[model samples]
Target chain A: MKEMFYNRPKPLHIKGRVYKFGDNINTDIIYPGKYLSITTEREEMARHCFETVYPEFLKIAEPGDIIVAGRNFGCGSSREQAATCLKYFGISAVVAESFARIFYRNAINLGLTVVIAPGISKKLEHNDIIEVDLKMGIIISKKNREELKTIRLPSSVLEILSAGGLVPYLRKKLGVEQ
Target chain B: MPTIAEKILARAAKRDQVKTNEIVMAKVDVAMSHENADVVIRAFKEIGLKKVWDPERIVIIFDHRIPAESEKSAATHKRIREFVKTQNIKYFYDMREGICHQVLAEFGHCRPGEILVGTDSHTTTHGAFGTFAAGIGGTEMAGVWSTGEIWFKVPESMKITVHGKFKEFISAKDLILFIIGQLGSDGADYMAVEFHGSTISEMTIASRMVLSNLSMEMGAKVAFILPDEKTISFVRERTKKEFTAVLPDRDAQYARSLDVDAASLRSQIACPHAVDNVKKVREVSGLKINQALIGSCTNGRLEDLKVAASIIEGKNVHPDVRLLIIPASRRIYLDATKAGYIETLVKAGGLVLNPGCGPCLGAHQGLLAAGERCIATTNRNFQGRMGSSDAEVYLASPATVAFSAIKGEITEPC
Candidate 1:
C-alpha cells in the first residue's frame, strides 16, 4: 500500500476570546461524575461544561473562545468528557500553565489544541483577545500585544493535531476515506 | 541507564532501550474501560473504523452505577453491550463482575512486563502485577482500540523504599497516605514511582495494589513493583500461563529516592478537601462522622473486608452513623460471604451493597447530605466527591473506617 498520509507538521494560527480560570481546576468541576451516567452528547456535555465554576459559561460562550487556566488544569479523573465538552463548544484552544498528564493526552487525541506557556496565567485577562501562533510557539494578548512563549510540542504531536487528532491521522495514513 | 519503567516501555516499543523524556509508540497488551466505555465506544465509532484493531485485546466492564441507576445509564450500558457484540469483543464483563480494575487483575489480564491502559485513574492498581499500567481518557482509549498502539513519554522514576515491619493495624493504605502527606499532591507529578524494599516484597497481591492505586492521588502517571515470588505465586494460582518477571537493573537510574520506616508509621488519615492533607487517627479521634464506607478500587479486596469484619465483628455501628460495605468484585463478595465476613458486617448494623463502585465516585448509593462528614477507605477526598459539595470526606484504611463507624467518629483501630 502506498503511504497516503505523511508526517508533515502544520502550524496552527488560532485567535479567540479568553476565559480565565484558576489552578487545580479538576475534571469533576469541569464535568461532574453525576453527569457521566446521564449523557455524553456534545451538546449535553457542553451544557454542563464548567457548570460548577461558571454556571453561565455555556450561555455566554462564543465559538473560538480560548480557555486559560493556572497550573494543574484538568486535574482529577481520566474522563475524556472534559476535552470533548470544550471541543464541542467550539473552543479554539486551551492555554494553561500546566495540565494533568491524562488530560493533556486526551485533548491531543480528541483534536483539542492545548498550549503550555509558563506564566501565561498571570498575563491573561478575562475576555481578552488572544492569538495563538503554533509555528512560533507564541501566544499573544491581541489587544495588548503581550507575547507569551509556549513550549514547542514534538513534531509527531503537531502532525497529529494538524490532522485533527490521531484517529483522522491514522485514517489518512492508512488511505481510508470517510 | 534506563529505569524499570523505561525498560518496559522500550520492550513494548520494540526498542533495545529508552531514555527518560523520550517518546515512543508502544504496543498495548491490554486496554480497558468501565461504564465509561460508552464514551470510548463512541470515539471509536467517530474513528470511521469498521472494527477494533483487536477485539481480544479490549476489555469493557460495567461496574460504576451498576444495574443501571437511571434510565440514561441503562441506555448507555445498552449501547455499550451492542457495541461489544458488533465489534465481536470477547472480554466484556457485565455488572455482576465487580470493579473494572479488580476484575482485570482477578481474571489475569494484567501480566508482568506488559503495558496496559484503562479509562479510570485507579488503573494504576494493575501496576501491582509488574505491568506498566496507567490511566488514560476515553478518546485515547478509543485510539488504542483502533490501533493497539499508543505513544508515551517515558517518565522519570521516583523510587520509594519502605523497610521494616508495620504495626498490627497499619495497612498499605496507611503507608501510602503517609507517603503522600510527605510528598504532597504534586510530589510525583507526571513521574513513574517504583515501590521496593522489604515492606513491599512482603505484602500480598491485594495489599500491593493499595499502594499503586493511591499513587494516582500524588499525580504519578504510574506506580509499579518489580515482580517477585509473591507475584509469581499470585499469577500462577489465578492463571496457568507462564510468565517472566520484570526487574530493575542493579544500577537503575532514578530521579529521586525516598525512604519510609514502616514500623514507625501509625494509622494515617487524609482529612477533607485534599488527599495529601494527612493526620494521625488519634489527632481526629473525637471528630464526629455521619457515615463510614469500606470499599473502592483502592481497598475493597478480600483482605480489606476481612480486616473490616475483624474490627466490627461483634460490635454495632454508631446510631448516628450509617456504615456501608461494598466488596470490590463478585469473587471477593463470594469469598467474603463464604468466610462469613459479609454476614458479620451485616450483623453489626452495616449495610452491604452489591459488588461494584457505588459510593466511591458518588455516582449512586450512600450519598452524603449537606454538612455531613464521612470516613471512607476510598481514595480521594475532594469536595462533593460523595454527594453534596457541603459534605466533607475523610480517607482512611478499612480498619479505621470500620472502627470509626463504631465510634461515630474518626477513631484509631484497636
Candidate 2:
C-alpha cells in the first residue's frame, strides 16, 4: 500500500507490445469516475483502470507495454488520473491517432509518453512489439518491420518531458534544489 | 493583429504580444480543485511544499460525490478540509454549495480576460464569463499552487458564428448539439473557440454557459464569449469585481470559421455512447426511459429549471418514470424555490435533490440498472457513465427532459 513512483526515476526507453483499442476511448473507461476519491495514490488508481470495460486489463498487460488507439483517445471529463492510471497500470506509452486536449497535456505533464500517429491503431495489432524514438520520429513495428508514422514532438514538449514532468520542470525553473 | 486568446495569454504571460503555438509561462489568477483536491494536495506535498504559493487565490469545492458515499472519500474530504484550513484558502465550498463551475460563477470568482485553471474539464464553463480558462492535471495544478504559474501554448482560435432565433423549445443546448454533430468530437482539438454572431449576443448567462461548457466536447483548450453589458450585469449582480471586456481584433485570424443557423435546428439528442452521435428528436423519439435528470453545470441553472417547471406545470410525472431535478448551486436552489420551480416540480412527482452533481458522473446518487435508458439535461452520454455499462444515456435540453419525464419516453419538447 506504499506509493509506487515517488522515488523512482522516469523511464526513457519506450518499446513494448501494442495494446489496441478503438476510437473515442474516454477517461471514464481509462479510469472510472467513481473511484476519483477512493485514493489519490497512483497505484490504487491502477487497480481500477478499465475496471468495467476490459476488467482483466491489468492482469493481461505487462509493464512497459504500449497502448495504440484510434482518434480522441481520452475524451470526456478532465480527470488527470485517466492518463496516470494507464501509466501506472504499466502502459509505457500511448500511441493514438489523436488525443483529447486535456488528456494529451496530462500525459505529457506526468511524463507518460504519448504519440500522434495518424492511423497506428489500424496498422498495429495488439501485442505487437514496437520501439518509439521521438527524436527519429518513427515507431518501428518489430513484427512486420514496417516504419509507422509519428509526429516528432515539439521542443517545448520535449523540454518538459526531459525534466520528467511539469513538477520537476517547475522545480528546476523555480530554482528549487533537491 | 492578436485575437482574443492571443491578447489574454499575452496579458497573463506579462508580454506585449504572443502568437499561435508560442509557449509562455502565465501567472495563475485562480487555481481551483474539487473532488480531486485531495489528489492535488497529495501532489502538492510531493512537490516538497508545505504551503501553497498564494492562499487567497486557491478555491476548493466538494461537489462530485458529496456527503461521502464511501469511507475513503470521507477521509479524503477530511484531509482536504484540513488542507484548506492550514493553507488559509478562503474560497472553499463544502457539500452544501454545488457543482464547482456553478459555485464559481455564483460567487463571481471568474472574470473576463483573467487566466483561470481548475481540475474539472467543465472548467471551460467559466469561459462563459470570458475568462481564459482551461483544465489541467492535478500535478500541474499543484505546480500552479506552488509556483503560482503554469505554462500554456497559445492556441489558434476557432470562431463559430451563429445567427437567427431559435424556434420554441429549441434552446442553446440543441444548437450546440447540432454544432457538435457537424464537427466531430475532435473538431477543434487544441484550439480556442470563440462563440459569435447575433444568436450568441442575445443569449442569457445560462444559455451562453451551455455553449461554453460543452465546447470541451469538441476538444477546445479554452472557450469564450466577448464580455458584454449583460455579462457585466450578471457578474456585478453576484460580486463587486470590476470586469474587463476582451474584444477580438477587427482582423483577428481564425483558423476556421463555421456558421450555424439556429432557426433551422431541431431538438437535438446526443445518443448513447458518444456526445457527437447526435440526431433529431423525431429520429429517436418514443425510446422508453427509466430516469430523467434535469441538472448539472451544463443545464442546472435557474433558467434551465424554469423551462422544466413550465413544461410540467400542474402535471404529474409519468408513473413509469423517475424524474430527478437538481439545481446547479445553492443560490440557484433558493432562487428556484422562491420562484416556485422546485415546488412545481415536486408537486408534479419529480424528486428534488440537493444542489450538487448528482448521478451525472455516475459516481453516486441515481445510477441506472443494466439495460436501462435515461434522458438527461447534463452533458456527455458515454457508455457506463450513469452506472451500468449496458445502461444508455441520451443527452438533450431541459425541456426535452421534462417532456420525457411526463411521457416516460424520449419525446420531443415541442
Candidate 3:
C-alpha cells in the first residue's frame, strides 16, 4: 500500500508579513475573465493577479506572506483561479472577516488555506508579522503575541483541507494509488 | 421537518433526513461544464485520474466560445471532444446546442430530487426543476468526476413567498430583480432560497427558471420552486423519466422568510457595477445606452425571446444602439425562428447570433468600449461584466431590453 502523504493540520505557526486588502475583493480583480482564453498557467496568473486593482501586486507579494482582508473577500465568480493565483504564489493563508460563498468553496477546493476571522483585519496593520495555527484556528501577532479567534471550520472541511484538497482525500478514501 | 432543498439533498445523499449545517456526501446525478470543460479536463489530469467515476453522469457543453472564436478555443474544443469520446460520456452538446442550462432542462438531466453540479455559476437555473443544482469550480468538478460524489454543507433555507398578480410588462425577471434589490446582493449568502405562493405557482417553467437563475444574484446556493403540475408537465414533455417530486414539509424551518406583493411590482432594473444596485425603470430611464443584449441562461428562453420580438416587431432598432439577440438553446432558436420571432427581430435590425452564451461573459461578439452603456436581459451587472471595465451594464427584462433598444436608452416597456 502506498502510504498517503496527507496535509495534516498542526499548530502551523506560519511567520509572515501581512498584505492587507479591503472588502469585497472580487475574483475579477484577482483573475480577470479577459485572460480566460490566454492560459491558466500558475505563474502567468500570479503575475496578473490583482493587476487592475493593485498594480505591481505580484512584485510586492512574497512567498509565505499572508493576505488579510475585510468582509466578503473573494466575492465574485466561481473561478478557481482566484484561489490558484494566491496559492501558487505561496500565500500562506487568507484571513478575512468573511468570504463570498463560491469563493470560499473554490478556495477550499483548491487546497488554499482561508479562514474567516471576524475583525481580524481591524486588528492587523500592514506588514505586521503574524503566526496562524491552522488546526486550532488562532491568529497571533508576532509583535505582541496578541491572539485573535477565527471561525473554526467544520470537521469535514478540515479533513478536506488537511488532505491537501478533495482530490487527495478522495483518492485515499478510494484506495487509489497516486 | 425538511425544506425542499433538504428533501432533495437527503435523497441524493441516501439519508433519512439531513438538516441545515450538516455535511453529507451526495451522489451527483449530473456534472456539467461548458468550454470550461478544458479547465476541468486539465484539472482532472493534474489529479492523476485516468477515468471519470461515471461517464454517463457527466455532461460537456460547448456554449461559452462556440464555433471556435480563436485558435486557443478551437484547441480547447478538440481536447474536450477527445475526452468525451475516450470516456464515453453520454451527454455532450456541441456549439449548435443552446446554453448549458437550457440543454440540461430540455434533456431532463436534472430531475426533481436529484443533485447536479456544474462549472458555471448559473447552474442554479436547474433549481427550477426542484433539483439541488449549484456551481462548483473546475477543480472541484474534476474531483466529482473522479469520485462520483461531492461533499455539501446543507445550507439553511430562506422562504420567499410572492402573492398577487403582475402588472403590465412585469415578468419573473422584474420580480427577481426587485427581490435582489430588496435583499441586497449578499442577503442569501450560503443559503438555499425557497420561492413559493400563488404568483410563483402560476409562473411557467421558463418564468420559474428566471427566478431560480437569478437566485444566485443574492448569493443563494440554490433556489427552489416546489414542483407542481407545470413543472411536471414541462419535465414530462422533455423526458419520460420517472422521478419523485420534492417538497418542503409544512413545519420546515427557515432561516428567514420574506413576503413580496408581485402584483404591485413594476418594471425593475439593476444599475451599473452591482447586481444589487437596483432602481425602478422610470427612475433611471433615458440614460443613453449604446447596446441592448437579450440572452443568457437567465432570460434567453423562447418565452423571453417572444416578449422581445413582440415589442420590436415592425420597429427599427435605434440608429445609435445595437441590439443583439441570442437564444438560450438551439431548440429555443429553432422554435423562435418557426414562430417568426427571429425574422421580426432581424427586420428590427436585431442581430441574432448562434445559440450560445455569446458576449454575456464579454468573451466575444457585442463587446462594449469604455464610456459605453448597455442594458442586458442577462443577470449580473457587476462592473466590466460585459466588456471594458469602464463600460456600464444594466440588468432588466426582455421587454425592457427590446424597448430600450428601440429608444437608444433605458425605457419602460409599453
Best by DockQ: 2
lDDT comparing candidate 2 with the true structure: 0.88
Model 1, A141: alpha-carbon shift in Å?
Answer: 2.7
DockQ of each: 0.45, 0.63, 0.46
Backbone clashes in model 1, listed as residue pairs? none
Q: Between the candidate structures 1 and 3, which one is better when assessed by DockQ?
A: 3
Model 3 clash pairs? B98-B329, B165-B263
Predicted candidate 3 versus true structure: per-residue lDDT over A46-156, tens digit per residue: 766776547777788888899999977876567777888887787878999988887888777767888899999889998999988877789999878899998988988
In candidate 3, what are the lDDT values of residues B1-414, reduced to their tens digit? 889888887888999999789888898888999877777887676566678999888998888878778888888888889999999998898888889999999987878878889988788898999988898888889888988888889999999999999998899999999999999877888889999899999999999999999998788899998988888888888877788888899999999999999988999999987788889999999899999999998999999999999999989999999999999998998999999999999999999899888888777888889999999998877666678888999999999999999999899987
Tell me which of candidates 1 and 3 scores higher on lDDT: 1
- Model 3, which residues run further than 4 Å from truth? A1-11, A38-40
Q: Compose the digit string of candidate 2's lDDT tens values, residues A62-169.
A: 788898999999988889889888877778889999999789888887888888999788888988889988777789999988998797777877777757777677
TM-score between candidate 2 and the true structure: 0.97
Q: Model 1 off-target regions past 4 Å?
A: A1-11, A53-62
Ranking by TM-score: 2, 3, 1
| CAPRI grade of model 3 | acceptable
Report the Cα lDDT for residue A92, model 2: 82
